[model samples]
Target chain A: MAINTEKNSYTVIFAVVMVVVVGLLLSGISQVLKPNIDANKRAEKQKNILYAMGVNENQGANDVVFVSDDILQEKFDTYITEQFYLQGGEKVDDPEAYLIDIKKEKKKAEDPSYDQKLPLFKGTKDGKDLYVMPVRGKGLWDAIWGFVAVDETMTIQGVFFDHKGETPGLGAEIKQRYFMDDFEGESFLDDGQFEGIAVAKGNNDPKNEDKSDNEVDALAGATITGDGLATMLRKDVQKYVPFFKSLQN
Target chain B: MGLLSRKDANLILDPLADNNPITIQVLGICSALAITAKLVPSVVMAVSVIFVLGVGNVIISLMRNIIPSKIRIIVQLIVVATLVIIVDQVLKAFSYELSKELSVFIGLIITNCIIMGRFEAFALGNGPWKSFLDGIGNALGYGLILVVVGFFRELFGSGTLFGIEIFGNPVEKSGLYAYGYENNGFMVLPPMALIVVGIIIWVQRSRNKDLIEEN
Candidate 1:
């Protein structure tokens, strides 16, 4: 059978072949860049954690330090020694898996393969042993996630907050250092007790002067976001109070 | 089909001016509005679209014959998707940071109607080279309007180009525009792009009476 060029244009076949060629080309490129992209993501997550804990300046998104993979592991190891997970008040079988990809588990709950667990990262800064817990929930406009590091006694060491689709310059201030810096040295426990932090209005001047230290000032124009952050922190941090107490014992 | 080529060019070019995509067609209004807030990204988006539209047209046109008439749309889609992915991957590799900023918009190029429109109307019937030229032409036509609208938006919106402060900020560290010195809160919003595109349409119609008649 002779294929006639008279009726069938070689252009058509050429284009289809080109599509397959280009597809394979892009796949190859994606594979080559895969490690760099993955490394960038991991570095970014670590930088956010460090920034939240007041160890690094919150310069801006995309401004995080891009250290080599080896250095990153070393730096992360210096701070985060161990991690754990809990169910009700008992320890889960494999808490280590939670650290593999917290973002994955946080995004979906239907995956029974992932046991619902809170992964804790143990870190020591200035001779203080701090436990970092990841919390995620809905904000005013989109998803909000953060890392809160608490001392063995459960004093809040620092906090970092990130959101998607929040109003920029207003609710988005959660990403700003000024806002996160306030979380530093702010006690989660007030009056030798763990009532956690309260997000309040008007400088957070509580009626009870004693509770003021446990209050974080509300973002001027972002009431819903502030309240949402407070609500998320209250519920999530409360879950680990028993586990944190166990560490003390 | 010989006589059709002449008629087709007229039909396509007519919509570009009289039935303008951004203003009249409003087909790709989303990116038009969002990216216009910043000059560089808007320009980048425009160029990227032009590349995709032009190349997609050429590819689809070349494949017009053996495209199996029943599943033509699928063939066009495969070609378009392939081009979009290539562009998306290229953007990520070279401009990793900017790619993150653009986020889903790059991937959404697959859904862009201008690209699909070119494939359906022109590429499917034309030769490879003509389809390529027509793709570039339509993309150029689309991009022309975007840059013009984006110029005004970025100038007044943020007083910056590619995030560089073009208009020397004032004593209060405010830009040339007193109202929108810090940032044009309005320009960042998607609706502002619509308003800019709307004004461009109004201007085009007022100048070209032919456009008004079509409207």
Candidate 2:
């Protein structure tokens, strides 16, 4: 005798069973793989932080360099010397800058104190010290983030930008070296004022004459995303001004 | 029919050419357009989809008889989604970069329409083994379109295939680059992917007379 599989009671029972099974299956898999996923994300973040400090993959025209898992960890340890958090011009007790995610922090609109803490990474290579600052903001469709590094003079040393869902070939160019290179050598302070870099749109050809002007040519077809990057970079950099200035004394 | 028999072989191979899920049925074209810009992600997406479709078909087919007809769609979806989530988690764990490149497209596989179509049209009515073959066939069909588009897109759009420079440096102005062979930037966009698919369908229809519609 075949069961009445199409009965309303059977349908409801099957639905409940499936929901429970799928939920358990997903949760189990996620739990088992959480450690590995977390490690991969941390490694990638370390790689980007390294990139912002000017440590790119082995340079060659056509050669692709593949760093093993151990070497990646070793490289991060060698280049980055210190990690700490700064809140209201004072160094906080948090030594783990890698644990804080600015993307998640940006979502808590109700938490006005969310911006109080900013993670700062100190990296050194070739006897030169660098401060790596993380910035994040909303792009055309999703989150855009990057590490902007500076030197003793507060000039932009290098940048490594990335985006989640920005339009490819347009706003996605931020990840490309050429776009990030525009920020190199650009100063953050304008005559002792904390003036951030300006991502100017449609002003591609000699936009400004002042050499000390903190301005860079924005992506041609990605004005809104460029503007978003500009705003976030300014806001994030401004938060650490007091801490950075305190180091001089 | 026996496994790998003449009839059974057609069940697996026909979709690759004459009856492709992407070209003939026009299913799962969104991912075909979205992830084909780079060969690595396209290949990964194909592998992920094949795994999901193949396992999903087998699981759904085995339970088809006991599944409540009123909730079959939900049942098929649960199986497909469970498999996709597994693939997503594994990708995140092992190959984070590719996972990032694929991003939301991997999660979007549940809505691809090809897997669900296979479940409703074939898996529900066929045995587990036959449904397994059919699922692999349709997925390979979809993979063919995606890989082909990815090859051309990466070649012309970036002067590279799988991130390897093929015809000298496209960015350099000196040496072999002065021939003015600039990368075709438009091929990287969504509209160009649709155009590439149209070209494939056009070539396919021309070769197979039965596929062409009467004028």
Candidate 3:
């Protein structure tokens, strides 16, 4: 029997109907899964922070243990306190709208206030108040973002890095716990001045007479990525300087 | 609608062996080259692809009759995008960290040629059952290459497989896998994936010379 797979009215109508049905079905399923996805993201962020703090004992980056979503949420509620924009040395009055997503605003260059609404995460570790501030900037070929936890005096407690397009083994080493460990106990402020962090290159002996806590060696082979990171950190860290200073009083 | 059956399982299995997309057809090599660096992610990607391709094929075939020729491509796209979004959302909900690791690649599946090609070429004229089988067969074809590439990249790149240390590291006080050959860090680089893919294609062509011929 010769089947007429022609583009007749019935065929076109059927196709449109089928497409709509499938679209609706998939959307419904996606709606059902949305909550799970959000939970996962929160848990992963916690896992990364723990790894950066050297709390995870696994040798490979893969072995960082993740607690269940319920447990993670419970811990997060009790521990992590999400802070929004702190302008003029005071936390924003209405932080709801100020919880800006920098990712969504990158394309538009019109708003100067866009840069001020900083999203900060604060929690406790080892009986000390650890304030984790978010930072974002360019890497050699892509964007790099991370969380830096600083103690009461603005000294670095831990750092967690995630990048979009940095070269592996070179710039991508930022994701390694050892690289982040280098930041522990380092100072974001030196001599009462906010000097921020530095990305130097090579065997930068922190013991070398000239090296200071504000500077750490960059990955050897990724010069562009390293330079990009240094520039990005310089710019992003400055945005939170006021917020950090306000906490002192 | 009834023309496609397991009786013609060759229609499905043949692609995996000879008309392999990643190796022979080279239809969807982008993901293979990028995500193969890690075993867990590569495996997740492979499963995601299989899911999308299989579903897209069956849906497109079922709706082939009603879709307007002038707007068929757009209709196919809607179907593909919907499936990709569902998979992405499902991953996010159930395995958030793994989903993050998979990242934009899951969304990128919407553009993967294997799904589009199967829908347009094979599924548009077939029955839902036949299209589903064809989808699995073609996905297997693409997935075989992904697994091979992912295995090599993860094994050598990270000095481990699925995060487990296969070769001991004397430097890290683990063991001895030849003092300095602990981990071939180069395997993790994207360029290494390209080279590995190139080798797979080379081997595939050598075994089946007919694949080299332009159809």
Deviating ranges (above 4 Å) for candidate 2: A58-68, A104-115, A204-211, B1-3, B173-176
Better of 1 and 2 by DockQ: 2
Cα lDDT tens digits for candidate 2, B72-149:
888888888889889989999998877888889999999999999999999999999899999999999999899999
Per-residue C-alpha lDDT of model 1 across residues A31-61, encoded as one tens digit per residue: 9877766656656677656655556632343
Arrange candidates, best DockQ first.
2, 3, 1
Residue range B1-215, candidate 1, lDDT tens digits: 56457755664575467656666666777667666666777777878888888778877776666565655777777777877777777776566656766666777778878788778987888888777767776776777777887777777776666666677663345545466445566876678878888888888778877656542
Q: Please state the CAPRI-style docking class of candidate 3.
A: acceptable
Local accuracy of candidate 3 as per-residue lDDT tens digits, B1-215: 37656555876888788877777677888888778888888888888888888888988887676666777788888888888888877777877678767777898888898888889899999998888888988898888888888899887766778877777753454655665566677888788888998988788788877878777
Across A1-249, the per-residue lDDT of candidate 3 in tens digits comes to 344546476566766677678778977887787677655555676655544444444654443354455565566555555545554455763323213555564544346654345556667767777776667788887898776777768777777788986765678887775676677776777897988777776555643234346787677787787777777777777777877676788
Q: Candidate 3, residue A199: CA error in Å? A: 1.9
Fraction of real interface contacts that model 3 preserves: 0.61
Chain B TM-score against the true chain B, each candidate:
0.84, 0.96, 0.92
List runs of model 1 lying over 4 Å from the truth.
A1-33, A55-99, A103-117, A122-131, A139-142, A150-157, A164-185, A196-228, A246-249, B1-20, B23-25, B89-96, B147-155, B166-183, B207-209
Which is the winner by DockQ between candidate 1 and candidate 3?
A: 3
The lDDT-based order of candidates, best leading, equals: 2, 3, 1
Q: Which candidate number maximizes lDDT?
A: 2
